[model samples]
Target: MNPLYSPTAERADNRCEYCHAPELVFNDLFKVEHIVPVSHGGSDNTDNLALACRSCNKYKADFQTGTDPDTQTTTRLFHPRQDEWSQHFRYEEEIGEVQGRTPVGRATSDRLQMNRAAQIAARRLWMQLDLFP
Candidate 1:
């Protein structure tokens, strides 16, 4: 890892801050991503960094906000350093889905495919093994 990139995996408990997927489950190590992109003037400060899965990092890119498909409105995505995860998303064990509790959550979910098939399957397995909440 680059010196500029802190080990956010430890801070995030080996989880992707965006999707909460365990970094250990991925084929390779997760990325240390900027909460805001450098192209967008985001800095290299650790406070602005997050551990991210390739899927979430690639999907999020430089976007800080996203469109809510259900409402057709633009809303801010969840901020790992600033926003409370539980305030926006709740893990539904019954369906193994990350349910959006607010517009921000909903938009973030849609933009990042948080409830995509693969993630849902992973969540189900994680839940069964007592690895997920």
Candidate 2:
């Protein structure tokens, strides 16, 4: 593991910064990811890192902008370091889905595939175990 990984996971409460799911619920350890791509001149500093699941990390890749499904507007993705999660997203525990409340949120949510079936199934189990949102 990268030495920086432990602290990044700790800082993110062992949850995915984007999906907000606990690492314990996943089969593999969560990924320590660059919130901004190193290819984009992003740094490896702790401030530029976020804990993410394999799914989110793979889906997000290096892109930070997408069209908002709700508005069809091109917008910047939600910056876990800069944007407040609650301000942009709302967790619907009943449906086990993260609802994006804003354009940026919706774009991020859609691009990240936050509501994919595999994720929802895992979240359902986590909720039952009292380890989820």
* Predicted structure with the largest lDDT when compared to the true one: 2
Model 1 per-residue lDDT at 8: 73
lDDT of each: 0.86, 0.90
Encode model 2's per-residue lDDT on 1-133: one tens digit a residue.
8778899999999999998988986788889899889999999998899999898899999998977997899999889888999999998899899879999999999999999998888888899999989
Model 1 scores a C-alpha lDDT of 0.86
User: If scored against the real structure, what TM-score would every candidate get?
Assistant: 0.92, 0.95
Q: Residue 81 deviation, candidate 2, in Å?
A: 1.1
How many clashes (backbone atoms < 3 Å, residues ≥3 apart in a chain or on different chains) does model 1 have?
0
Stretch of 10 with least lDDT, candidate 2 = 21-30
Which one is best on TM-score? 2
Where model 2 places Cα greater than 4 Å from the true spot, the runs are none
Q: Give the per-residue lDDT digits (tens) of candidate 1, residues 1-133.
A: 7564446777888788977887766688888999988989999899889988888998999898998877989998888999999999998889988878889998998898898898899989887777787
